[model samples]
Target: MKNYTVVAKDSFTVLGIGTELRSDYTDYAGITKEKADFWESIKQDGRLETLKAVATNNYIFAVNEAVNNKMMHYAGVMTEASVPEASRLIQFPKGEYLVVKGEAQTAEELSNKLTGIAFGQVLSEVKDVAYVGGPNATVEMGQQNGILFGEMWIPVVRK
Candidate 1:
């Protein structure tokens, strides 16, 4: 059995990353890797008072808390305005997600794990809601490798 610990998440600010069809599932590695690299450089370059990291796949971005200020394109997941297309509407359902934590000291490590897991297991959690289609996402805060780690949230629909 896949082991998952149930826990309540603290409400945290996030960057809701969106991508067009061309950007979805395609060139995910190239695009996300660059973003993660850029974010990581922010600290070393002294652009960020605290370090920030962002990892991306074609459909999602795993971003650090320091990137919170750069978060935009929020489909307002916290608000009711983000309902799916009217004709495409279904019961607004939420799921029991298997949120996972990982640590990658550098941009490459973080990017690889995120992109791999994103298209691998997390997509398995949500059944029919645009795994390949463009969707905004949530990424939160955590710690690992004695460094700040980010938590990626994949909103799944309950069975």
Candidate 2:
């Protein structure tokens, strides 16, 4: 079973890149490829290091918006530095969030668990905690450990 916590967070911004994905949950290979490509490109061009240098925290975000079969996914860092020309910037306004910790042997496993289970559970049960919908921001925080450590952040407000 997975456990969650509600935390108040200040507003933050992320600088990186993104791509839109459209696929049924049963066929997410396309979206996975797109995310991998974005990360690979950034690493190849040394942009990842640039963003990491100015990052306020070690957490990297894999933000997503899934409505119906369409999803827009962003792989980015929480940073105050100017994004590279090849990258995009996303701003997450201040809000309370439902946070959950996750661990996996690989990044792919981590992503699957967050999207397929963790976030789903939070969204469905948030009302029990007086959660009110706010921004649609769903952020996946990446850990620096050898094992893939992640935290999923879902924005919500108290009713």
Candidate 3:
């Protein structure tokens, strides 16, 4: 079973790169690979380390939103500092969120697992405790230690 927690969070901002993604399940693999490639490029160019240095928190968030049936996926760090060139900034409003935590062997695995739990499990389970309709944001948080950990943050409102 997946372990999760419900918590309240304050408003925060993140700055990083992103790409448009389709919500169709068939496109999942391609989008996951694309995001992985982006992270790899950032690491090779030393941009990942730079963002980490000024990051307010250790969590690297993969934020997503649905627009016109397509998804906008953003891989970024939460920080108030000025981001490097080409990075877009997104602000997350304060709200209650359902947080699911887990560890994976690779970024691909983490992405798949988190997505499954967020949409498949959390969405179904949350109906009894909270209402998740409206404009809710989903975030996949990266690991902090040596382990490849991931956390899914789903914004919700108590029923």
Best by TM-score: 3
lDDT values for all models: 0.38, 0.65, 0.68
List model 1 lDDT by residue over 78-128, tens digit each.
Answer: 222222211111122244333555556653465456546655765665444
TM-score of each: 0.45, 0.73, 0.76
User: Which scores higher on TM-score, 1 or 2?
Assistant: 2
Choose 2 or 3, whichever is better by TM-score: 3
lDDT of 3 at 96: 83
> Order of candidates by TM-score, top first?
3, 2, 1
The lowest-lDDT stretch of 10 consecutive residues in candidate 2 is 131-140
Per-residue lDDT of 92 in model 3: 64
- Cα lDDT tens digits, model 3, 51-132, are 7787887777677766457567666777778655435677666988777877887665776687777777777876545644
In terms of TM-score, how similar is model 2 to the real structure? 0.73
The deviation in Å at residue 26 for candidate 1 is: 0.7
Rank list by lDDT: 3, 2, 1
C-alpha RMSD by candidate, in order:
10.3, 3.8, 3.3
Worst 10 residues of 1 by lDDT: 83-92
RMSD of 1: 10.3
Q: After superposition, how far is residue 8 of candidate 3 from its true place, in Å?
A: 1.2
